[model samples]
Target: MKRVFIEHIESYLPDERICNEQVEQRIRAGGFDIQAGLLEKMIGSEIRYYARNDEQVSDMAVSAAQKLLHHYPDRKIDLLIFAAASGDLIEPATVNIVQQKLGLTCPGFDLKNACNSVTNAIEIASALLLNNSYKNILIVSGEKTSDSIKYTNIEKETIKDHFAAYSFGDAGVALLLTTTTEDKGLFYQRHQTFGEHWNLCRIEGGGSMFPNDASKLVFSGDTFGLKNVIYEIAPPFVKDCIQEAGLTVNDIDLICTHQVSKDTYRMVAETLSYDVNKIMQTFHLYGNTAATSVPIAYQQSLLDGRLQKGNIVMLLGMAAGINISVQLMKV
Candidate 1:
């Protein structure tokens, strides 16, 4: 089988930067009484990026994809897979918009698995490469939570839940998965789904299941409803994925888990007895960028000199449908 490697990766944040202190102040002004370290403890984030009101998820994804293409201008991309939850519009698929904007002629489509979209895209792209169907595949994942965020009546839920209303930042990320004799490439990947938990963390009004009406958006107290589904199903999914990779928790050099919350991260780390330091967190700063979290963190790790070549890295993500996916890669 041919090897699938990440040729390049890039991420884009809104021009606005929201620091932890600012978030604390915002929540406190709203009478939430959240401490400064509270968010740090919950999501291991110091600051997060947010998109502007006019910016759409597709805009961010396109910007990041353009950056990646600029960096590696010589490569010929044959396929583009856009994995995202909060796209620009309801119809026409975000990938179509991205394809039009970037002028990318390669075959492209959108993949939706909630937060696990990117992970699923990676698995599919790898299979395509191995089958000689495509040589280079560009995967873009992003989320603009701020666009749909509702800042009122947040006190109805626990701090963890309410914090997400404010804490979840926005970001876009792009990755180039190619079939080459590159030294760094994916080793294995696994995906699983539990559709029973689909309605747990979802936007009840937007999709075909619940068609968004004026009342759904206007009367709805919360936009992305609840985090209970994620809290319930993610831990076991993480463990299963790790175990299926044929490696113990300790074998992972660095875990690039999805950016949900500090509680979620700690629970997974403790369950596997893995060191907290082994996990790279961006939620505190970037909140949950849905499909973009892991890839964004992976890019940051490379920029910061933390993720070096030859290291064994694991990309894990859990999204709606209570879906779970893990991709083990040798960098």
Candidate 2:
């Protein structure tokens, strides 16, 4: 099996910035009794971006891809994978639209695993590259969660449970994975799903189970869009993933946990007895970008000099499928 190396990576954040101060004011103006500094203390996101109303999910994805494509003008994309919970349409795969926008002739498709979509694509791309099926694979994700936000109906008591929903913002990320002769790319990857907890967090109205229609329509907060209930179930998976990769918490140089919230990842680190400083965070600045969070953080680490070549990095992603996935990579 050939190794897969990430040749290039980039992210696209819309110019629209929404600061915590604005969100707090809006929530307060909505006639809800809220304590001061509670939101930032809860999620730790001071600012995040939202795509323009005219921008579709594919548009953000194409913008992100162009950055990497511009960097490597001659690189040919053999496979294009669009991984995100937010898609442009329900019929045709969103990847087709992205492929058309980029003028790529490669075969393309979509992979949906809630927030774990990108990591899942990486695992699949690695296998394809190892089997000599494709030389290079491009994974693109555009998450426009702002479209689903429900701002009208709110009860003061239940709103606290839905605070995580407000933490989500819009962003896109692109990753180019090419075949490498060296054996130092992905060392270990593991994914576990708890179907019983699937109802903990989800968009109930968009799929076949609920159907997208006016009569059955539901708002993001009304459904379980951002409600998290896997706090106790997640720690065991994190420990197992490290052990499965033949590594311990101390062996990892950088750990990029999903940018869900400051409290969420902080609890994860404390639960695993891992060093809090080892975790690279973007939730404080960009909020939760869904599938793009890990890649966005990974790219930021590269720019900030926290992640480097040959560094052992661990990526932890948990999503609405009640899914927990971890990837141990040698960058």
Candidate 3:
């Protein structure tokens, strides 16, 4: 069977930078009880980017895909997958928009399971590559989480649900994968979704259950975002992923877990008994970029020399659908 390898990866960020201090001041000056420097300590991100009003998820995705194409000019991508926690529109899947924007004639579609979208896309793409379904696959994700936030009446759930909202940031990520007969590729990949906790984190509105209606909208209170239970429920699955990969915690050279927050990842590290230093993270600089978190951190790690060729790396993630996925790759 042919193996799949990540030929190149790239990420794009908006120019607008919002730091913890800026967000805190903005929230406090509006007569909220938000404390000073609390977000930085609680979530662990110093700064994050906010997309411009005109920019949507597909726009950022096109930018990232363009960069990936430029980097690997010779390769031909036969399949395009746009995975995101948030989509651009309600109908006509967002991947269609991305495919047209990228000017790709190949087949395209979307895979969404909240934050686990990209990880699952990789799993699907790898299977296709190994089975001779497609020669080259392109996966891209763009998240505009700042657009989903509701900042009013936040004091009601101040220390509870509202706090999780402040940690969300925006970003776009692209990855190129192709068949490689060499021994280095995906050795083991595993995924499982625990729907019992599906309601733990979600956007209840703007869907079939609660269609978007201005008359029925309520913004001040939990207008649909993550809850406090995600951090509590997601850690136990890390060990299952490790065991599935046929490796112990120590065997993996670097682990690129989901970028939820500094505190969340630290708790995950402690629960799994893995070294905190070995966990690659980009949340401090980018906060939680939804499905783009793991890929962005992976790209940063490759650039910073923390991850190198022939290293065993694991990508573990948990998303808003209360889903968790772990994939182990030999780079």
- Tell me the whole-model lDDT of each prediction, alpha carbons only: 0.76, 0.82, 0.79
Error of 3 at 105 (Å): 1.0
Alpha-carbon deviation at 315 in model 2, angstroms: 1.0
Best by TM-score: 2
Better of 2 and 3 by TM-score: 2
Model 1, runs deviating above 4 Å: 20-45, 153-163, 214-237
Task: Compare the candidates by lDDT and give the number of the best one.
Answer: 2
Write the number of the candidate with greater lDDT, choosing between 1 and 3: 3
Off by over 4 Å in 3: 29-31, 157-159, 214-236
Candidate 2 lDDT tens digits, 43-96: 774688999999999998999999999988988889999999899999799999
Candidate 1 lDDT, 99-206, residue by residue in tens = 898888888889988778888999999999999899889999768876555444446354543355555678888999887676668988888788775544555667
Better of 1 and 2 by TM-score: 2
RMSD of each: 3.5, 2.5, 2.8
Q: After superposition, how far is residue 61 of candidate 1 from its true place, in Å?
A: 0.7
Model 3, residue pairs in steric clash: 310-331
Error of 1 at 27 (Å): 6.8
Residue 14 shift from truth in candidate 3, angstroms: 0.4
What lDDT tens digits, residue by residue, belong to model 3 across residues 1-331? 4678888899999989999998887677656767777887777756899999999999988899999899777778899999998789877889999999988889998898888899999999998988888999999999897876655555554436446667778889999998787877777787766676665565667767678664222212231344345555556566776776678888988888787667756766787888898988678788878899889888888998997678898888777656778788888
